[model samples]
Target chain A: MSFVSLRNVTKAFGDNVVLRDVDLQVDEHNVVCLIGASGSGKSTLLRCLNLLEVVDRGEIEVDGQTITNGQVDVNALRRKIGIVFQAYNLFPHMTVIDNVTLAPTKVRRVSKADARDRAKDLLERIGLAEKADEFPDRLSGGQQQRVAIARALAMEPKLMLLDEITSALDPQLVAEVLTLVRELAETGMTMIIATHEMSFAREVANKVCFLDEGVISEEGPPEQIFSAPQQPRTREFLARVLAAGRL
Target chain B: MHEVLQKFFSPHAFRVSLPDVWTGFQLNLKLMVIAEVLVLVLALAIAVVRGLPGRGATPLRALAIVYTDVFRGTPLILVAFLVGFGLPGLNIKGLSTLSNFTYGVIALTLVYTAYVTEVYRAGIESVHPSQRMAARSLGLSYWQAMRYVVIPQAVRRVIPPLLNDFVGLQKDTALVTVIGVAESVQQAQQFSQNNFNFTSYVVAAVFFILLTIPLARFTDHLIRIRERRERAQLT
Candidate 1:
């Protein structure tokens, strides 16, 4: 069985339907990239997987556990999955080390000393060890995003969702955050990345899915999806990306 | 100008009335401190209740809204009179045993709690919803997010405004004068009647100003420090 599976998932905000009958499968240690235009339900899909948004209709199973069933403990379910958003929502009131260690010490009941040690390690991995004491607003955009990722990884989640994590970053700053993500992928971390960086997606993603409006129009290995897209929508998107020099 | 100064700020009259006015101002100090403590605790509770999610808290939210609205709209002096004379007039069991000073404290607490509850609610709401989402995503329960992450930040942000309300509360402590409580304003009125000099009222005014100036300045200092810190982060 796939490590994570979404079956006919549909989500809507009031009358504005953002996702429609989307089915997807992800295997262990596979980096799946979701590509689409803005408003193609990519963010919402990621949010639904993390149960941040309740689906109008569907079932999601991650690691053989049913996410849609009401019996599952939502908090416990979330502990296994970590999501980093575009805006790098670090708690501005907290120091970097404190932001990363908060969940471990409070929710996981790890000793404060142990959590701090683990948080330092994560920060070190992200090349932000010196910034552990700094507040989020004091950091550059890329640095803040890295810290946000480190904060999510502190939980040691089995799957990481990167929702356009570099979208808000400057062109120069994007590479630093992308480099960190690339390292995460190389280390065999299972990630579902929603991104606009086509080259990065092609280089890192084992599988790429092209979404249109609210549907996954085409999905295949990156080599096939990027080079020879089957769906007309996929081809048109790639053409637009090419014309804009993003592909 | 000389006559006005002599009537309002006469040195001899001020010195004569100082001891009596000082006694009355002590009551004002006591009322303010006690009322402040009560307002802090009670207003926070009400604000949290009002922010409670889901239909189960509908009645609670309604009650909180009504309480804040009614008390905030009513004049502080009227509330003081109602709490003081009306409670004893109720003639309930063991009601008359409570002193007028305690009644004054109760009245101030009720009105200020209403005002500060809105302040607290505003502070909590001002914290971006994304902060709450980030906390919850980390596996913290709703109340845990609020208790540890949200409330501390909210309280810090609201401190200047909170102190602003207390400054008003300190001045309003004189409202108990209407209920025949021996607060500074009442003592000043008595001194005016006895000596036919308004200098005692000046003494009382000076005492109020003395207490408020330090607090008002402290509040401004806090606001400046907070702004500087926040701007430093932005740059």
Candidate 2:
């Protein structure tokens, strides 16, 4: 069985359909990149997978267990899946170390000393050990985004969902955030990333899914999806992306 | 101007009444301390109940809304009268009788809590929704997220406004005098009536001004520091 699977998922907000009968699968350690224009359901899809947005109809199975049921413990389910947003929603009131350690100590019930040690280690790995004592507002956008990633990592989640994590950064800062994602992927962390950065998707994603207007129009190995897409919609989207010099 | 100043600040009148007003001033300080603590605790509780999400909390939210509305709409003097007199009038078992001082504290707490509840709710809402999202995504439950992440930040932003309300509350403690609580204003009234001079009233006003000016300045100091910190973040 696939490590993660969604069967005929559908979601809507009033009359606006954000995901319609979408089916997807991800094996263990697979890096899947979702590529689409704004309002094309990429972010919504990731949100649904994390149960941030409940599906109006469908079944989601993680590690062969059905997690879409209302009876599932959402907080426990969320602990196994970490999600990072575009806005880099670091707790502005907390120092970098506190932001990273809060979940471990509060939610996971780790001892304070152990959580601190693990938070420090994660910050060091992200090249931000010197910033542990500084508040998030004092950090640059790139640094804040990295701290957000470290904060997510402190949970030691099995699957990581990154929703346009670099879209809010300056062009120069985007590369630094993406580099950390690449390192995470290399270390065998399973991730589902929604992105506008096509080249980075091609380089890092094992599979690429192109979504158009609440549906996955085409999906394949990154090479096939980027170089030679099968579907007309995928081709047109890529053409526009290429015309914009983004490919 | 000299004649007017002499009437308001007559040295003989001020000196003669100082001890009487001082005795009442102590009562004012005590009432303020007790009432302020109760207001903080009760206002926060009301705000949190009103803010609770989901269908299960609808009744609680409605109750909180009605409470703030009714209490805040009524003139405080009337509320004080209602609690100080009405409760004793009701003559219910076990609650029919209490010290006038206790009744005075209850009255002030009820009225100020309504105002403070609104202040706290504004502060709680001012915290960006993204902060809650971040906390929940890390597996914290809704109440847990609010307790650790939202309230602390919200409380920080609301400190200056909360202090503003506190100053208002401190001054309002004089209102309890209508219930025969014998605070500074009541003492001033007695002196003015007995001595046929209004200078004692000035002494009472001076006491209030002395109490509030430092708090007002402290609020300004906090605001300046917050503004400076935000500006530092921008550059």
User: DockQ of every model listed?
Assistant: 0.72, 0.85
lDDT of candidate 2 over A1-247, digit per residue (tens): 7889989999999999998889999999999999988999999998888788899999999877798888788899889899999999999888999999999999999999999999999999999999999998889899999999999999999999999999999999999899999999999999999999999999999999999999988999999999899999899999999999988
Candidate 1, residue B57: CA error in Å?
A: 1.2
Tens digits of lDDT, candidate 2, B1-235: 7776667788999999888898998888988899999999999999999999999999999999999999999988998899888888998976668877788889889999999999999999999998898899999999889999999998899999999998998899899888888889999999989978888889989999999999999999999999998898777
Superposed by TM-score, candidate 1 places the C-alpha of residue B126 at a distance from the truth, in angstroms, of 1.2
Give candidate 2's chain B TM-score. Answer: 0.96
State residue B5's C-alpha deviation in candidate 2, in Å.
4.9
Residue pairs whose backbone atoms clash in candidate 1? none
* Residue B151, model 1: Cα distance from true site in angstroms: 2.2
Q: CA RMSD for every model? A: 1.7, 1.4
Residue A83 alpha-carbon offset, candidate 1, angstroms: 1.0
Best by lDDT: 1
User: Judged by TM-score, which candidate is best?
Assistant: 2
**Chain A alone, TM-score per model:** 0.99, 0.99
Model 2 alpha-carbon miss at residue B157, Å: 1.1
* Candidate 1: tens digits of C-alpha lDDT, residues A135-161: 888799999999989989999999999
